[model samples]
Target: MSTALVLTHSVTAAEPSADGAPFGLAWGPITKVPRPFKAEHEANLTALFYPHGWDPANGPATAEVILVICRDEGLQQVVWVGLPMSGEALARTRRAIHAEGVRRYGEPGVGGTADSEVWPGGRALLASREAADGNRELVMTAVGPGYAACSETHHAETGHPAGTHMADLIGTGSP
Candidate 1:
């Protein structure tokens, strides 16, 4: 099969805060060469998401991107990021992303899943499923304000803008 690289991002309403920091999670750009997938790729990606300990049923929200890196050796590697999203508006954003995936790639081979954790303030951590193909899928969820903090941390740690990193990860040049 011909390999494909996919990346998606969704914007949610920023949460109101007296602190006035831009509220929303942003994953740093990651880079990967395009590749096709087999069943193992999907399984591996799913396994990665579960370890973060999030459950989507609890009302946390997420945004994610899936990357499939195919090799001549017949193995595909999938990578993803889980960002927190919560509440009704964030949930709607997640659903919209799912719909977009279905429209573009047809039915995903796997359904979305999530794991949760607690962060500072009232915010919670989440990892929700995003998109999937025969080979890979992505899941993410995070609180609005908390998301922004995480994004900042990611940028500081990586030394490059998240959007730029994402572009490199998916080989899409730029977002």
Candidate 2:
């Protein structure tokens, strides 16, 4: 129903990446209006852990109105756009997002979680079922004050791994 959600679905499925630069360099300008959540993060109005995100200088997104791209160690993973609904509304917001993820992606992947502990935000390259006929779709993860979020698409195949990889990569480690 939400355009940004739809965009997230499409973008994650596409798995945008870069050879030697940030994807935003080609995603066009910061002129395009972002979704409410993205706009909030851009203004630092959300619980976003900054320095992980950046707005496009100028092409056209066709991906995310706002995104967090990390090119450290020359390891560029898929470019995914996420929104954090922290504070009092986090749980409810994550539920809505998780429902939406299932609606678009069918079922959760092998290591996916459809429970209350973790909330869906956005994901990609996911499996629908467990068998060989399983589907590779999208998913989302919730983020908050002590808890940071990462694209669950990465963990879908490996089950729930402990520790915070995003934190280590972003220097927000030790959380």
Candidate 3:
């Protein structure tokens, strides 16, 4: 994260200013002026590398998505970037993810899904599995939508209890 924050300005000037007061799309960092971000954007990067049984030390054998929520208007955020593997590529990622899910969460709870009413009016799908291997358990969320420019994936925990987290993205019950 850089100190520079990109913003849309209403000022219709060709350049900043002749007096060189200081003004443009870049505002550096907000050190004093209280311009609070009303909403929240979470990445859950703790499980970013591998929530699956795979060993992170073995290397980066996984994929991920960086959801860039651009606009936050309370109850919902309209614009965003959702990236994940898809089609033949998704199949490869899911195989590895599924193997870990079944190994850690045991069989049956591992599955996937595709939806028409995906976020932002498009189709999307995800295949993830969870196991009772540890406090973090092990879950893999690999998804991409027609609306998004790319595919994305996640390996994380149930956060609360083992069975509390539902794989709603998969349209299936938890393992």
Candidate 4:
């Protein structure tokens, strides 16, 4: 039941733009997303994605793009799950993802596993991690007052710290 918690610590990056959208999807409202997705909702989080699957240009073909929406706050995160692969594919995907992050958000911040890297941005936090089993994943979470508001609401309701859950919610580990 491991879940990937959203990074709540203070960041120097500017606040997320209200209109900013990652993965061609905007950052507010679930209705804005297209249909034909396998969907589920629990508490303040709603997870959905096209069952046919959408793959990032630089990502692996097996990857599933999961859209995470925070109730009331709209689309808060975009998750890309790359199914387990051989060493070479894993390494290549990791490098490509990291390079994309660097190009978009510049150098990453401290505190990343050898298999992971995180880039803080004015609009969101972009991160990528590779599981021990060679599952590569990339995550982007919206930042700013809207996110803080949602976090506070989530904490008040769950009695636990607010953060995104990957394993239990989306059925994966160390996303």
Top of the candidates by TM-score: 4
Overall lDDT per candidate, in order of appearance: 0.30, 0.28, 0.23, 0.49
Clashes in each model (backbone N, CA, C under 3 Å)?
A: 31, 13, 6, 1
By lDDT, who's the top model here?
4
Name the weakest run of 10 consecutive residues (lDDT summed) in model 3: 72-81
Q: TM per model? A: 0.27, 0.26, 0.24, 0.65
Cα-lDDT of candidate 4:
0.49
> Which of candidates 3 and 4 reaches a greater TM-score?
4
Return the candidate ranking by lDDT, descending. 4, 1, 2, 3
RMSD of each: 15.9, 14.5, 20.0, 7.0
Over 4 Å off in model 3, which ranges?
A: 1-82, 110-175
Worst 10 residues of 4 by lDDT: 6-15
Give the C-alpha miss distance for residue 70 in model 4, angstroms.
1.9
**Model 1 agreement with the true structure over 56-152: per-residue lDDT tens digits:** 1112222322322222111122223424334664467645654543443344442112232223342321223323432223332222333344434
TM-score, candidate number 1: 0.27
Error of 1 at 86 (Å): 0.6
Which runs in model 1 stand beyond 4 Å of their true positions?
Answer: 1-8, 11-70, 73-78, 107-175
